[model samples]
Target: MRKLFATAFSLWAATAAQAENCQIIGNQTLCDDGVSGQRIGNTTYWNDGSSSQQVGRFTYNSDGTSSQQIGNHTYYSDGTSSQTIGTTTYFSDGRSCRRIGNQISCD
Candidate 1:
């Protein structure tokens, strides 16, 4: 039971860390991970200090790699992806975060 509790805590901490880096400041959602986005109509335009180009729903990185969001699924350039089903966003890394009100809780 202790092991399970520890594991749960770790996952919670990871999710908290990710959520802490992100904030809803005015009209933009900003993150310390070098990504910020603003929704315009049906598309969310992302800026990472390099570009603000919106091709479909993908955000291109400065490294020539890009990440795209289709429906609720996000495809990253690193071959990893995440999907949002309901109020939760599940990462390819096995982490899942749930949106609670204006905050995110993960486990």
Candidate 2:
């Protein structure tokens, strides 16, 4: 159907636009949309840089274990979200998570 085709094209175009901003710098691909991912030395890292502080990292180590953090702007499947303005994550259950500045509160 024409409507289905248009909807699919719109989704694909949006995704392509989001992916096109990254630039290959050395081993890193840096994007204007607050994400940078690269292999730095022996470690692989992805970071969020929505603000000057750029507050999170997912890193892979040579030993096979990995470490990660969520910050800057994070969104949950429940439509809760976080960013420099702080964040809220809601669960399908009654529980919720919230962060304001450096403080985190959950229920």
Candidate 3:
């Protein structure tokens, strides 16, 4: 009976530890993978499992738009990079209409 009680207690303790190690925010689950930072929001996974050292960040706007900044890359709402040097525009149908510049190419 003592052995059984010890096993049950260990199981319960393990479960409680796991539950305390993670949090659910928005649609994302922030988990600490022992060495890394915590995760944040729904789309971003942070470092050492630490949310303080964010490895990635994603923001979804109310206008049916979204943006993501991962490392050195910045993504815009139109699924394009914000670092794009040339000027570009899109039509209502979600098609690239025009682009102009020496390094530019129209989509």
Candidate 4:
């Protein structure tokens, strides 16, 4: 499940939407309407309004591979977020490793 979770997180991080200048409005809420992605430096943010909100970042490696990262899942909105150092490394060889907290899985 590590790989799956990491892959999902990475996908969202790469394709999430940001509200141009999305900020905490009305008790930490944002104006994100989901399906839009924004990259402010190394941060990314997305919200589906229905409850799927994500925030993360990704980097394109010099070797043609890539990686997605985030400090932790602190933007779930439901206060049930439980992630630490979510990371997924995509190798140039088509292999990948996903590590969340202390669990590592590859596929």
**lDDT (CA) for every model shown?**
0.46, 0.31, 0.28, 0.33
- Give lDDT: candidate 3, residue 4: 10
Off by over 4 Å in 1: 1-21, 30-53, 105-107
Which candidate order results from sorting by lDDT in descending order? 1, 4, 2, 3
Greater lDDT among 3 and 4 belongs to 4
lDDT of 4 at 12: 31
What RMSD does model 3 have? 22.1
Off by over 4 Å in 3: 1-56, 84-107
Model 4 C-alpha lDDT per residue in residues 1-107, reported as the tens digit of each score: 21123234432322221111122222232223323333343333333322222234533422233444445432222222334443654433344445454333444
Return the clash pairs for model 1, or none. Answer: none
* Candidate with better TM-score, 1 vs 4: 1
Worst 10 residues of 4 by lDDT: 13-22
TM-score of 3: 0.24
Report the C-alpha lDDT of model 2 over 4-59, residue by residue, as the tens digit. 11111110001121122334456554445545555444333555321111113433
TM-scores for candidates 1 onward, in order: 0.51, 0.25, 0.24, 0.21
lDDT tens digits, residue span 1-107, model 3: 11110111110001111212333344333334332222233223333221222123555433344445544334556644433222332322333312222121222
Off-target runs (Cα >4 Å) in candidate 2 are 1-19, 41-43, 49-107
Candidate 2: how large is its RMSD?
Answer: 16.9
As for lDDT, the candidate ahead, 2 or 4, is: 4
lDDT for each residue of candidate 1 in 1-107, tens digit (9 for 90 to 100): 11111112111112233334344454455555545566454334455333333456655444465566778777666686777777666778876765554443455
In model 4, the clashing pairs are: 16-36, 16-37, 17-36, 17-37
